[model samples]
Target: MSSASKDALPLRHPVRVETITLRPMTFEIAAAQPDFAAIARHIGVASLESLKASYSLSRNGDRVKLEGKITAALHQTCVVTLEAFPVALKVPVKLDFVPEAELATLAAGDTGEGEIDIEVLLNEEDPPEPIVDGVIDLGAITLEFLALALDPYPRKPGVSFDETAPEAAPESPFAALARLKGSE
Candidate 1:
């Protein structure tokens, strides 16, 4: 378990993915450590912990597809009351990584299609390549998936929508009287 720095609002942790050399791959991150606070901040949550993920990677020529399951505990401030609320998530994520060159070729209107180059796509400029050992970084993926899954507005349990409820009248006696008369 790695502890985060106390000064920053968000914490940061390094996750390592195990390298693999096969297709239809399966990887595990047994009890991977993550900077929960940082992840929470990234996802606009109050806090997070106990994150884990397991996944499989498949390569068909130059296209890499990843499918995985993620589990984590999260805390966030209630949108209605400003109180802290905890949430749990168990979600599956699937993604396709495509090479920039192929994207460019396709964009430029290339017709005759050939096989894509996986190595070239893996070596793209931004966003470092995913670590792919037998061990995967469950923590990082959990954070990412959680961010995608999180609700922008979170309310406490049992909260209900009341669209039909009457809106509060303006804080003037005349306005209140007018509303009351209109309702009648």
Candidate 2:
């Protein structure tokens, strides 16, 4: 990679709060493709063949709702076979970006475990994420969602491991005698 290309890479896209309007803003990620590929490697993937995200940001008072979809072509090494194969994933994006002030309120008002929303906790779906510096890093958030949706142990088709028990220790020749003694 050239220095100029590195210079062009952006770590995050922090959208300003004041600029947000009712109309949705579109952001494409080709300029930072290299950075995203690096993220894939960091997360144990062989490669991120391609990545693209389209999001619509809308503010509801202090909170921002980000809804979009991420389409990625990836290369992952199968855990069972150790062979790299291509995978195409289309992951849905639904996240609520909460302001720091509101987060403080939520933290202070927490009662106990009983009050927690079990549906949100148990599901693989993400809960509201914090927005920092009055900006939301949609690109970073998209990558995070992809990481969560990825299979931890990807396997090639028709690959399987047996779970049957070992044959009962070869029936002993004394088995019949032992059974007779136990009967008494």
Using TM-score as the measure, the top candidate is 2
**Candidate 2's C-alpha lDDT?**
0.73
Model 2: how far is 95 from its true place, Å? 1.3
Q: Which residue ranges in model 2 land beyond 4 Å of their true spot?
A: 1-11, 31-33, 110-127, 163-184
lDDT score of residue 35 within candidate 1: 59
lDDT of each: 0.61, 0.73
Best by lDDT: 2
Q: Please give, for residues 1-184, the per-residue lDDT of candidate 1 as tens digits.
A: 2223222323223323223334577766544345565556667888776666677877655555678897778787787778888899888887655555555565445344655434435655433233332233444555567678887898889775556867876599887899899998
